[model samples]
Each structure stands twice: as structure tokens, then as C-alpha cells.
Target: MVFWITLDPLSDLSRPPGDLSSGDLLNQVLYVALYCLTMAKLIDLGWRGARPLLHPAYLLLLAWFAVSAVLGVNPGTSVRRLVLCAMVMSIVGVLPILPRTQRDLELWLGTAAMIVVVLCYLAVLLVPALSVHQADAPREAGLAGDWRGIYDHKSTAGPMMIVFLFIGAFLAGQGRHLFGGVLFVLSLVFLLFTGTKQPTALMPVILLVSRLALRTRSRLLFLALCLGALALYNLMTVGSAVIPSVSDIVAKLISDPTFTNRTGIWNFAIDRFLERPLTGYGFMGFWSTDAVLQSDPLGQLAWTAEATDSHNSYLDLALTTGFPGLCLALWVVVLMPLLDFMRARLDPTKRGLALLFFRIWLFCIFVAALETVFFLRDSAVWVSFLIAIFGLRYLACYPVRP
Candidate 1:
């Protein structure tokens, strides 16, 4: 459902959002049906052990989203987006239990992710206009000729390929040599053409940390490191804009330390967030709404007003959902997921599955520091992150039955 909705929902890629109106409605119906099935299956399975979805974190976040929606700038837009988010979250609630065992999980993930890869590759080959970014794109015009491959932008496609790349690795470990080799090579080749530097660079970092995590007795240190890395990155990019001193320090290192003008957007976001640090502009309100997007900031960066997001999920959350919501998000997204990975790693048999989810969870959280990824409306990375969190939570508590 995720692959189909993200990749094949639109008939016309040129103007996808409007063209996907009917498709979105259809997908929503499908979501409702699948959600029912997932709930029924959970009931049939005794619902006790399969209680990953019942975590307080998820509930609290949902409640916060609801509250933010009501108090947000555009209540109507917030409500619509919140409904869609609920449907997606509900459907993914049962993904961890869908597979009977670890082997079956590998098979399902391999086949599904490969199908997405093949469709992306075929689009790039047959309809370059649709699959690849053109020189004339409205945003990120410099990204022309990069491969987006049935996605709205190369940024989205790059992370999806990385997810597939790991599925390929898992398949290889499971003795599906031919499938694994082809999937890995193809995913790697496609990822390179996307020209997304962060994902490409972070892959190795995630792998290295995962290796350390498995061998070490403490996952807490690694968690601290993760937080540290994000902190340093924020300090470099947005922090520079917030403090003149930080910008002075970063300027000594890089010629354009603003990370291609991301700090300008961050600065504007920070200014607004300070105005209403408690309640925020509301869900889907800060950046996407017409009032905010069209409004002119006379002394601020003009481009920042027209920007899509704060370019930092942490800051974006604070801007839209307030500081408390952001803190709740940190608990839900960052801490518990890693702790789940740590617990799941105790069993040697569950090692591979645990690591897979660990890697996926790790990548998303790190990526979140740079990108606006938390609840970004069915984004591929956001969907995969939820899947990883659920997978780890389930694995930590229950065994994969043969």
C-alpha cells in the first residue's frame, strides 16, 4: 500500500497533487479496509503481545496533534491532514505482526521493496521526463538531471533507495544471493544519481554505529552520540543563525556555512516560534498554509516566507506544535525506538531483524535533524520510520514464530 500510494498513485507526474485527488480518495478507502483487517487480526491474535501500537507515546502524540489542529492557524487544513495521518498510522500499526517469522519478514520486505525499485528504474528508462528531475523544476532548479524516479523530488527518492539497499543486504544474509546482489547494486546506482549528499554520507555512519551498538554492552552511549551529532549539526546550521557567535565560528570553516541558505529559513522560523512558543501556528499551518506562505516578512529573508518547511524537523515541530510537542516527539521518535532496538538485540536469533529496524530507525532520526520528516504526510521516510519503530517494539517483546 505504501509503495503503491507513494509511487503509482498519480497518472500524471507533471501535476501530481491535483491529479491525485481521486487516487487519494481511493487510497483512503483502502486504508479504512486495511485498518479494519489489522484490528481484527490483532483481536484474533489475543491482542496482548501485539500491543506495540498501544504505547502512550503514540497516543499522546496523536492527542497533541489533535490539540494542535484545533488551536492551529488553519483549522480546516490541520484537520484534513490529521485525518490522513491517523489513517496511515492506523494501517501501519499491524505491519510488525503481518509476517509470521523473521524469514517471512525478509521475503515480504524484499519482494515489495524490489517492486518499488523496478518501477522507479523503468520510469527513469522509459519516461525520463516523469522519472528524472528536469532543469526547469520550480524548486531546487540546481537539482536538474538528478534522478527522482516517480517521486516528486530526488530528496524523497534517495532515502527510499537506502531503505531498499538494506533490504537487499538482509536478503543476501538470508541466502537469496541473486536477489540481494541485484537489489543492492541497482539501489546503489540509483541512489548515486539522486545527488542527495546527506543520505549517502550518513549510511556509513549508521552502519558503523550499528556495529558498535551490537558489540557493546551499552546502547545508551550510542544514543547520546546520536543526540550529540544532531546537536552539533543544529549548532552548525540553525544555531549559527540564532547566535552571531556561532555564525562567526562556522564562517571560519566553510565559505557558505549557512548550508546553502538553510539558516535564513531557520532564522525566520525561530523568530516566529518565539512569538508563540507554547501553542504554535498549528499542525500543517506553519509552512503549508496560504496565510503563512503568502505573508510578507518585511525585514526577514523573502525566500523564507515562501519556504516549504523550517528544513529542520525539530525546529519545525517547535514552530508548528510548540516546545512541549517537540519534547514529546523526541521521546517517541528518538529515545523509545533506540531502547527497543537495544532490548531486541539480546537474542542472537533476532539479531538481523533487530539490526535492520535499528538501522532504519537510526537513519530516519538522524535525517530528521536536517529534514522535516516527522508526520510529513505519508512521506516514504516517515512511513518507513513508523514501520521500523513498530518492528523494533514488537521484536523486543515477542519472538518471531517459525
Candidate 2:
């Protein structure tokens, strides 16, 4: 888990002894190591221990992705992505069988968070060239300086810090006050250095809402309130004219009149999504295809030509796998865990895991609006999300004492 979370082999600062090709070779080796370890652990669990792994929603989602990949515009690439997804999910499948108690879970979470925080600080202080983004590459408007802090990009580092911040809070709630407080402060410092505006602005609100939702009468009511709030926000922001003051405030906070030029990318992606409404371009298929690069469908848009993704997970999923894919994702990734957490809420012994899953689910859902995290291979956010979903399923199948 630490190996995957740290992504050591993929880090620019930790390149292989030789050239770029050797680095790719090392990455492949590490991936194999990850896959073998996951499978071996699953085998050790035996059929009885692994029975919970047969989650209906998870299986159905993987099946749908398989079929979509088979019929996708880029079958080879889609299949590769599907395999990687399965590998990550396989590792996640072990979560339930591990962690015998809430303390066990907390220990793991705190350890991982500390490791990340320490590594980030080390990179910033000791290896500035690799940790920070250089001026050679064009940056977002208003981002005079940005630090990635051991991550490949500021965008990646910022979201990661946001996640660790929550993890730190979780530790504090678990009674590890000193460790949690230190992690919280460190994560905030790294987030500020990254200069990631939207996430920094949204983190406090997300944490507050998650805490409030946990106190609701039932999961159904919580879900309803969440959906209602989301709808209200959407209605208000659908057009600046609907609520000019609110929109203006948001724009100024992010300091990006065009959302860091995301609007143009979203528009182009939506147009492409319309082109293949059913079983869209395929998983990670739209951006790299020869046809797309040759035709330049986005025209002279400044950001679109150089962009690698839609920037919005929902739109990216829809563009890659269409509405059906999007529906499956929301069901398996979001709604299923939510439902499971709700069911677990009925059991006093299961409430801890339930709350943990709920908080992680809320964070993922919120971040997806601004980042491409859905099913993204090897992303810390996506991996953390899988942990939440799989952890919820684990508790549902094998109820644990709080």
C-alpha cells in the first residue's frame, strides 16, 4: 500500500540508474511486484476469507469496463487501463481482511500520512529542482510560483495535501492529537506552497459538511440533503447571471476568470462526448488518438491542444465511456458505498468504518468536480477512494467491533 501510495518508482527524483527507458523498465518491475503481492495475499486469505471480494457492484462495474474496452476506439489502450484498474482493485480487495480493528486502520492511515508529509518536506527542502515546478513550463494565470513537493505537478500535490489534511483530522478524532496536529499543519503548508486555489478553498467546507452529514438521522436523509445541496449549487452556477455575486466571489477566490482555462477544455470534451454518446471514446482514449491530434477538434483554444484530460472527472468519464459508463461509475464508486455505509450505520459496532467511508466518499465526490480522479490509474486520490469503497464493503460482509 505504501509502495503504491508513494509511487516511488514513478517519481522523477527517484529515476532508475540509467536512462528514461530504464526508468520505464523499473516502473514495470514495480507494477509486477504490486500485482504479485496483491494476488498472493488474496490467495492466502482462502475462499472463505475472500468471499467478500465478490462484491456485486464492483464486479458489475469491472464487467462493464471490460465490455466497453472491447468495443472501444482504442482497444489496446483501454485493455491496458482495465488491467491496471483491476490490479489496483485487487490490492483494495485485501483491505477488509486486513485491519482487525479501528485502531489498526488508524495506525495504517497515520503511518502513511506521516510518510507522505515527511517525504514532501524533504523534497521541498532538499531537492527543489525536482519538487518545484520550473518557470520553463507555462503556468496557470496568477500562479507566480508553485511547488509540487515530490509530486510531478502542483495540481497533483495540492489534492494530495487536501486528502492528508482530512487523514490528519481523522487521526486527531481517533485521539492521536500530536501526530494529527502535526500532519494537519504540514499538509496545509504544502498545500499553500502548491498554490492550488480551488481545493484549498473547498477543503474546509467539505470537512465541515461531512461532519454535519454524519450527525443526520439516517443515511437516506443525509444523501437527500447532499443531493439537494449539489443541485442548488449547480442551479446557481449554471450561469453567472443566475447569481452574479456568488459567481463573482467564486471567480475571484480561484483567481481564474476561466477556471484556469478549464471551460474551453470542458466545452471541447462535451462536444466529443456528444459524438459518441454511447460507449464513448473508450477509457483514456480521447486525448491520445491520432484522429484527435490530427484534426484538432478544439480549434485554436489555448489550453485544449496541450491538455491531457477533460479536467472534470464526470465529463472525462462520459467522454471516455459515455453516460452508461458514467452511471455505472456513480453507482459502484459513489452510491454503493454510500448505501453500505448507511446499512452499517445501523450497527453500533460498525459505525467507525461507516463514518470513515462516508467521509472519504464525500471528499472524492467533491474533488471529482475539479479534477480527473475517477478510475485514474496510480493516482493517490483514486487509490484512497478505492480504499474507502472496499473498506465499506469489507465491513458489510464482516461486521467489526468499533
Return the top candidate by lDDT.
1
**Per-residue lDDT tens digits of candidate 1, residues 1-402?**
463338342233345234221236675676677678878887887777567678899899889978987898877777777787787776676777877777787888888888988988888899888778776555556877888887877778898899888878878877899999899999999999999988998888888877888877855686667667767877877789888999999999887787777887787788888987987878767674555644453534456444678888899999888888898988888888878887889998788888888888888877776788888767888899888888888888887774
lDDT of 2: 0.71
Off by over 4 Å in 1: 1-27, 44-46, 293-305
RMSD per model, one decimal: 2.8, 4.0
Candidate 2 collision pairs:
none
TM-score of each: 0.91, 0.87
lDDT of 2 by residue, 1-402 (tens): 553345642245333223211124555566678779867876776657767668686788788788778777877777777787787778766765766677888888878878987888887788776777665444432443588776777777888888788888777877889998999899998898898876787787787887777678766688886766655543333333235676686677555545655666666777778888888887776665543654474566654445667777877888888888888988887677877776777787777557767677777776777678888767777887887788777777776745
Model 1, position 114: C-alpha lDDT score = 88
Candidate 2 C-alpha error for residue 244, in Å:
13
Stretches of candidate 2 off by over 4 Å are: 3-5, 8-25, 138-144, 218-220, 231-257, 294-302
Q: Give the TM-score of candidate 2.
A: 0.87
